[model samples]
Target: METAYIKTPVGIARIEGDEHGVSVISIVDEATQLSPEIPNILSKAAQELHEYFEGERRDFSFALNPRGTDFQKAVWQELRDIPFGKTTSYMELSRKLGDVKAIRAVAAANGKNPLWIVVPCHRVIGSDGSLTGYAGGLWRKKWLLEHETPPVQHRLF
Candidate 1:
């Protein structure tokens, strides 16, 4: 798999993929070297990610090939269905998966999502509407959510 690193507002993002598709996009906190040149296979993903961070794009159009179990894949697919700036609770996601009791399992799969922002696991929240847990970091999650949020409009009465 070809790998590349790019600087994002949150931190350095590591992108991995090949001809098949992009398999991973994750954040790294430790100091790491950025790619001198992005590979042809990963250039679109890198550019799309930059567009996402810049608020120029709402949805990703590149191919994704995240490696995971069937259940995890199902959960990740549902995550993509969530609107660009909307949030959903773990319970609600479990309900959508047709198994309310699988809340824990859904949460586990969400936590294991490898595509990061591409899969949008950060959009999942606690039932109480709290920014619960994120593999990247809660601060980063908050930043992502805030970044996606549409600006408030004022009415001049």
Candidate 2:
């Protein structure tokens, strides 16, 4: 797998994948060195990420090859369907999967999502709208969510 590390507003992001598509992308510390030579595939991913952070893109368009079990794959796929700037709860996801009792399992899968922002696992939240666990840190999760949210309109009544 080809690996590339790029700096972002939140942290340094390590991207790993090949023609088969991106398999893993996780945030590293800001002190990490930026990749001097990015592979073709990883360069594409990095560019898309830059646009995402710049608010120029909402939905990502690229091939993904996340490795996981059948259940985990299903959960990750559902995470992709979450609209930009929208949030869903683990309970809601479990209901969508037709097994409310699998909330814990769904949460586990969401937490294990390897594609990071591309899969949008950060969109998942607690049932009470509270921010929950995030592999990249809750601060980064909040940053991602806030980045996706549209600016509120100021109306004079």
C-alpha lDDT score of every prediction, in listed order: 0.94, 0.91
Give the count of colliding residue pairs in each prediction. Answer: 0, 0
TM-score of each: 0.97, 0.95
Model 2 lowest lDDT segment of ten: 26-35
Q: Which stretches of candidate 2 lie over 4 Å from their true place?
A: 155-157
Candidate 2 lands at a TM-score of 0.95
Question: Where does candidate 1 stray beyond 4 Å?
Answer: none
Please, what are the lDDT tens digits per residue for candidate 2 over residues 1-157? 9999988898889999989998999998657788899899888899999999998988887788889999999999899999999999999999999999999999999989998899999999998899999989899999999899967989979
Give the per-residue lDDT digits (tens) of candidate 1, residues 1-157: 9999999999999999989999999999999999999999999999999999998999999989899999999999999999999999999999999999999999999999999898899999998889999999999999999999967989979
